[model samples]
Target chain A: MATKKTIAIIGASGNMGSAIAKSLANAPYRILLFGKEEAKLKSLFKEIKNTNKKADAEIIGCAADASWEADIIIAAVPFAAEKDIAEKIRQVATGKIVISISNPLNETYTGLVTSSDTSSAEELQKLLPHSKVIKAFNTTFAGDFSQPVINGKTIDAFIAGNDEEALETVSDVVRSAGFNPIKAGALAVSRTLENMQSLLIQLSIKNNYNQVAGWKILHN
Target chain B: MATGILLFQSITVILYYNNMYEVLFENVSKKIGLTKEEEQLLQTFFIPKKLRKKQYLLQEGDVSKYLAFVEKGMLRSYTVDEKGIEHIAEFAFEGWWMGDQFSFLTGEPSKYNIDALEDSELLLLTKQAEDQMLEKIPKMERFFRLLLQNHLIAIQGRLASSLSNTAEEKYNQLVQACPTIPQRVPQHMLASYLGITPETLSRLRKNISLRK
Candidate 1:
C-alpha cells in the first residue's frame, strides 16, 4: 500500500479544526493535531479515538514541527492568528499545500477584515511565498460540517488556488469530507469566495438560521 | 416447497461459510501460523462478499474502501484513458489480493476500475478493521508486512520485465507465472495486458506451439 499522506491541522482544538478532524477521522490520511491549548487537543484526540479506534492521529505540541512533518498543512486558526502561524511555519511550509479556511471577518461579523482588493488566502500566499495557499471551506459554517448536507443536497466547497495540482488535492480532501468541491478558479478568485462567506454569515445572522446555512450551486 | 427452498438456502449458506473462510484462513496460514482462537478473532473483521461476472468491485473516481482477498474465481483491475481505451493493470485469481492501494491508503479517488472476471467470493478488509486485527494479533502485522514486501518485489519485477522484455518474452513470462491465465481470461484481455494486439497474440501462440 502507498504510505498515507500526513495532514497537519494547526489549530485542531478550535471549532473549525475539530469539525474537520472529526469528519476526516475515518479517512486514510495521517492527521497531526496542533493547538495552543494542550488540554483541548488531548480531549479532542480522545474524542476522536473514542469514535473511531483506528484513527491515525497525533497531538503535536509545536505548529512548526507538525508543519515540517506534514505533506499538507491547514491553518485552521482565526484570521488574526494566520499571520503569526504562517511566520512560525514559513520555512517548513515551503513546497507544501497550505489551506486557508479563514474568512477574516471584522468584529460583529458584518463584513470582511480583508480589503476588497485581497482575500485572506491571497494574503497567506504572500506570507508563505513558496507554499501553495488554497482557499477552501470558508463559506461553510462550522455547524454545517457535521452534516454537510441540507434538504438532500450536499454543501459545495468552493476551492481556489494558484497551483492546479494543489486545487485538485484540496478538492479531493473536501470531497472525502462529504462536500461537493467546486474549483472556483485561480487564487485571486479567493477574494470572491471569502466575500461569499461573509455574505452567508450576515444572512444567517439576519435570519434565524443558527449557523446551519451552507452554499450549494444548483445545476443540471 | 417452502421447506425444500429453506433446505437449499441453508446448504448454500453452509457451503459458503466452509469454503470462503477456509480459503482465507489457508492463505493466511501459508504466511504465518495462527492459533484456533486467533483464526476465529481474525474472521470477525472480514466481510465476505460475492460478485458475479462483469460486476464492478470498484470504479474510477470511487475510493477503494477495502483490500479484497479472492476466495474463489478471478477479478481484474484496469484503467480507461481519456480517449476511452482500456488498459489492463493486473489480474487476481483465487488467493490473490486486489485493491487500489493509493486510494485505499489516502482516501483519494482511484484511477483504476476493478471488476469480477468470473463469479467470485472475496473477503474484504477495511482499513479500520485491519488496524484492529493487527493490534489484536501482532503476528498478523508481521504477516501483512511480509505480504507487502512480497507484493512490492513482484511489482518491481513486473516493472523491469515490462521495460526490458519483448512482447513474446512478456507472454512467455506471464504464462510461466500463471499457466492457466490464457485459458481463464479472454484472449483479447490477455493481449491487452501484454500490450499487444489480439492478432499478434494469436500469431505468437501459434508460433510457440509450432516451435514446441
Candidate 2:
C-alpha cells in the first residue's frame, strides 16, 4: 500500500482555510491544519473529522510557527499576513508546492491592494523563492468550497502558476473536490483572479447575493 | 410636396433613435443573444439624454442615479485629490459605460465626477428600470454580470499598475491599450489619467523620441 500525500493548510481556522481543509478531507491525502490559535485549529480538525468520517484520511492540527511537513502547503491566510507566513515557512516550503488563496484586496474590500501587473501569489513566490507557487482558490468564496457545486452548476476554479507540475497537482486536488479546475495561464494571471474576487465581493455586498456567488465560465 | 418633406423628416428622426438603440442592443447582444422582445424591453428601460461639452452627468457628493452608456462623443470620470488637483479615473467614449460603481451600486454619494468632454449622447438606466429589465429579461442579468466582470478586470489592472509599475511603463501600457487616447484627449487630462504630472509625461515622451 502506498503512503498518501500530505497537504497542509495554513490559517486553517479561518473560513476559507477551514472550508478548503474540509473539502479536501475526503481525498486520499493527509490533512494538516495550521493556524495561530491552537483551540480553533483543534475544533476545525474535529469538524473535519466529524464530517469526513467515512473517508480514509488522517488529520492533524498545529500552530503557525510549527515546522511544516507536507508535500503541498496552502497559504490561506489573510493577504496582510501572506508575506509573513511565506517568509516564516520559506525553509520548509522549499521544493514543495505552495498554493496561495489570499486575495490582495484592500482593507475595505472595495478594491485590490496589489498593483494590476502583480499579485499576492507572485509576491509570495518572491518571498519563498525556492517554493513553486501556484495561485488558486483566491477567486472562490469559502461558501462554495464546502460543496464546489452551486445551484446545480460546477464552480470554475481558476488556477494559475508558472509551474506546470504544481498546477496539475493543485488541479487534481480541485477536481477531487468536485470543481472544474480551469488553468488560467501563468502565475501573473492571479492579478485577474484577485480582481475577480474584488468584483464578486462588490457585487455580493451591493446586490444582496449573500456572498455565496461563484464564477462559472460559460462557453458555446 | 409639403407632406413628402414632412414624411422625410420623420423618417430621419426614426433613423436617429434607431441608431442610438441599435448601438446599445449590439453592446448587450455581444454578451447574450437577446430576443426581439427582450431588446425592445431593454430599450424602454433606458432614458436617452444629451450633455453638452463640460456638462456634468454625475457630480461629487450626489448619488449616482444612472449608469450612462455613451452612444456618441466622449465623457470623463474624475476625482479631486486633497490638493484640489483633478485626477482622471476613467474615460468613456462610444459604446462604453460610465458611472461611479460604488455610488451606482450602493446609492451612496459619489466621490467621483462624470462630465462630457464633447457634446455626448447617452442612454441612462436607473436601478429601478434595471430591476424591471432583469425581471422581464433574465438574460440581461448575465449581460450585466459579464459587464461587471470585465469592468473589474480593467479596474484591477489599473490599480495594480499604479501601485507597482513605473510611470514610463504605465505610459507605454496606456498607449498600447488605447493608442489614440493621447491624440483625442488633452495632455493635462492624459497626464491625470496616468496619475502623473504633465511635466513628467512630456519628459517621458521626449525621452522616448530621443531614444528613437
Candidate 3:
C-alpha cells in the first residue's frame, strides 16, 4: 500500500463526502472527517470504529468549515457553496492539493445552468489561484460511490487541473477507490468533461438506466 | 394588384429589423470577421424577427428551424418537466446565441421551451441557410464550427462549476459576469437557473445583503 497521505474531507457530513471517507477507510492512512455538524462527524467516525477493520490512519473528527485550509482537503460541498469553500480552502490550504468534487447542474439536475460559457472549476481556479485545485469524484453519485465496484470492468473517471502533480495525487485517490483516472489535458477541458457527465447521467436516467451501466472508459 | 404586392411584402418583412443588414454586418465584422461582400451576402440570406414578451421563439416538441442572433432585447431557453415546472436552461442577452442546439442539429423536436424575456429582435438563420452556407461560404464553415466549439466548451465548464461551486458562489459569479442578470430576470426564474428553490434564493440574497 502506498504510504497513506493524511487526507481530510471538508464536508464530511454530506452524502458524497461521507461516501469518500467510508470507501477509503481501509486504505492505510489517517482520515479526518471535518464538517460544520461536528456531532455528525463524530457519529460517523464512531461507526467506522465499530467496523473493527481498524481504520488504518488516525481517524479524527473536527468541525471546521470544509472550505477552510487544512492539509489535503477534499471539498464535497454542494454546488452553491463550492466557490466560497474554495476561497476559504485557499486561505489556509497552501502547497497542497485541494480536490473539488462538485457537479454544477441546474437546480433540477437537468442540465448545466452555469458553464455553457465557463465552468465552476475554472471559476474556482480563478478564486483560488494558488491552491492545486483538481476536479474529480464529482462525476459519480453517492449511491454508486459508496462502494467502488470490484467487478472486472474498471470505471472511467475524468481528472483535470493546472497542476500535473495535483492531478496525479487525485488519480491515486481514485485508484485507491478502485476506478481508473483519465488525464484529460489542462483545466480548460474540465468544462466539457465535468458538464458532460451531467448530460450523461440525465440521459442514462431518462433511458431507465444507471449511469454506472453506460459508464466505461476505453482502455485502448 | 399593386396594393396586394405591397401587403404581401409587408408580411414577409413584418417587424423585421429594417437595419438588419447594418446590425448583423457589424456583428459579423466583430465576431466572425466577415469581409464586406461576405457580410452583405450573409445579410441577404437572413431575416429579422421580433418576439413579443413571453412569446415562443421555439417550444417543446417543435423543430428548431432558426438560429437567431440577439440584435436587441433578452430571451431565455427553458424546459418544462412533466409536473409543468419551468426549468430555465439559459438566458440570452444582446449579442448572444439562443437555440435548442440538439433540435437545431438533429432536426428533432427540442425538449425545451425557448421564449423572449421581453419584446425582442433577432437576426434569424434557418437550417437551409446554414446548409447553403456550408456549401457556398466554405470559409464561413469555420465560424459556425468555432461557435459550436465555444458553446460546447461553455456548457462543459458549466457542468464542472455545477459540480464544484455553491449556489451563493455561483450566483455571485453570475452577478459579476452579467452584472445586470439578477435585476433583469425575475427572482424565481433566476433561482431556477441557479438550480435552487426560490426560497433558497431568497435566503441567499438575504445572506449576501447582510454581509454587505
Which of candidates 1 and 3 is the stronger one according to TM-score? 1
Better of 1 and 3 by lDDT: 1
TM-score of every prediction relative to native: 0.53, 0.49, 0.47
- List the candidate numbers ranked by TM-score, top first: 1, 2, 3
| Candidates' chain B TM-scores in the order shown | 0.92, 0.93, 0.85
Please provide, for model 3 over A14-133, each residue's C-alpha lDDT reduced to its tens digit, 9 standing for 90 to 100.
Answer: 887887887777665456777767677777787777774688433334323222213367877876887666544443443456777777778776877674667777777777664677
lDDT of 1 by residue, A35-139 (tens): 988888999999999999999888888887687667689999998998899877775565578999999899998888888899899899999876789998898
Best by TM-score: 1
Instruction: Give the lDDT of residue A140 in candidate 2.
Output: 83
In model 1, residue pairs whose N, Cα or C atoms come closer than 3 Å (at least 3 residues apart or on different chains), thus clashing, are: none
- Report the C-alpha lDDT of model 2 over B1-212, residue by residue, as the tens digit: 99999899868756645676667888887889988877765666665555658867777888887798998889999999899999899999888999887888898799998889998777777776689789988998899999999999999999999999999999889888778888888999989999889999999999988999
Give the distance in Å from residue A25's predicted Cα in candidate 3 to where it truly belongs. Answer: 1.7
lDDT of 2 by residue, A154-200 (tens): 99989999988678889998887778999999999899899998999
